[model samples]
Target: MQHAIAILDSGVGGLTVVKEIMRQLPQEKIIYFGDTARSPYGPRPADEVRLFTRQIVDYLAQFAPKMIVIACNTATAVALDDIRRHVGIPVVGVIHPGARAAIKSTRSGMIGVIGTEGTIRSGAYEQALKRISPGLQVFSLACPRLAPFVERGLFGADEAEDVVRSSLEPIMNVPMDCLILGCTHYPFLADAIGQVMGPGVKLISSADETAREVSAILYHKGLLSESADIPLHQFFCSGDPALFKQIAQTWLSEQISITPVIWQVPNIV
Candidate 1:
């Protein structure tokens, strides 16, 4: 096995997970695919999202990865189990790790969650948290506009602050000691979100915990790479390569190459 960890997202959001993985497991090689042309899977129907996710997974499997990470919360909510059952790899998702971190970080037992409408509607984080701590109070808000803004590469822009603040207004009335950025894309808007939520509220990004889970799984499976050389990382997107590459370089702080992959058209036999 090549021992590479493959990751997929609806769009650039998954880079958040990649960032954490690179920081914690610098030796592991990564192959990432983003469905940017049909970005923002959060609003699509479950079946449609599942189909899209499967299509991308089959495409990524060409790399013969040892594991796959479903870095988008909406996709993880709708497609993680289906992909895992058929893919036969150690597949990880952002929901559990994020919920676990939120559960631990909330000292007041009041936690708030913000994510794409599809993710919030799926109740994956709420379910995960309750399964672990039934008594904990959970409040969730669906920010339908956040993901689209992120996909457009508008983080930290002047307009982003107002959009983020408005989307988070619902949760401001709720008393939460911890707030989980339930969607990977939410981290890019954290500054605006933090400004609205104030300093006392702890913001939890699933990236760190999800990375740790990936490390743990690889360690347990004895798939940890022994190569001392700087590992190679490849990125592919189903959208504009230039935009994806620009964001990837800025996010990773390195000049990494991104190859463009188009979704294959099936022959009508």
Candidate 2:
């Protein structure tokens, strides 16, 4: 039987990874769990983050995914190790994949990563990059408001555009060959980010690299979906159904009929 992958994130940000997975590996089925109710995990405490992440992973495991992707940067920073220890399945996080990709893309040997405060403070990306290539220089900043902007469907609005530009100003003057979209909601502001950073600096989406990693791991484990036929994908949100579906359709640029799935927190635990 073909194995499905479970993708858990604090919110819609993980869709960036999911979208890439669908495009790159058409036959693989995916179960996406978005903890919209407790999103913007960037500011939460480590223990709280870990508990929340574990709940999502445990909930998704009900589907018996061959592996799970902790797609939120904050969750990956705080809870990845816990998830790996608790779950025997291959659990992958976005940090290493993104850091590796940045290393490969940087010409100036300098890279900038922006995510929620939790992600930046954890220093996971910085540590991961050094592990991959000790010589690479990494600069990271936190953007707590970015996720909220995207979540509220304000990504392209004038205020959001201004926010993107202003937030990027600090890193713009730095000499870097590439920037990592460390947070998943970030791809939604790609145009604005690219504009501020200029075309000279390539923006690397962790989602894209993470998806590629998913392809390799599944292939190596002999767990890649066997059926040549296209697989069904499901999306569940722990928040407003109409809003989730609306934002999903806009961000994905594809129609998504997402039915609301009321996820009980304590039940998963």
Candidate whose lDDT is highest: 1
TM-score for every candidate vs. truth? 0.94, 0.94
- Candidate 1 stretches with Cα past 4 Å from truth are 254-269
- Give lDDT tens digits, candidate 2, residues 93-208: 99889898988888889999998999999999999998878888888888887888888878878887789988887888988889999898899889889988998999999999
**TM-score (C-alpha) between model 1 and the true structure:** 0.94
Give the clashing pairs for model 1: none
For candidate 1, write residues 1-269 as lDDT tens digits. Answer: 34689998998999999988988888888888888888889989999999998988887777899999999999999999999898888999999999998877889999999988899899998899999999999999999999899888889589998998889887787889999999999888888989999998999998778999999999999889988867778778888777887777777775243333434323211
Superposition TM-score, candidate 2 onto the true structure: 0.94
**CA lDDT of every candidate:** 0.86, 0.85
For model 1, the run of ten residues with the poorest summed lDDT: 260-269
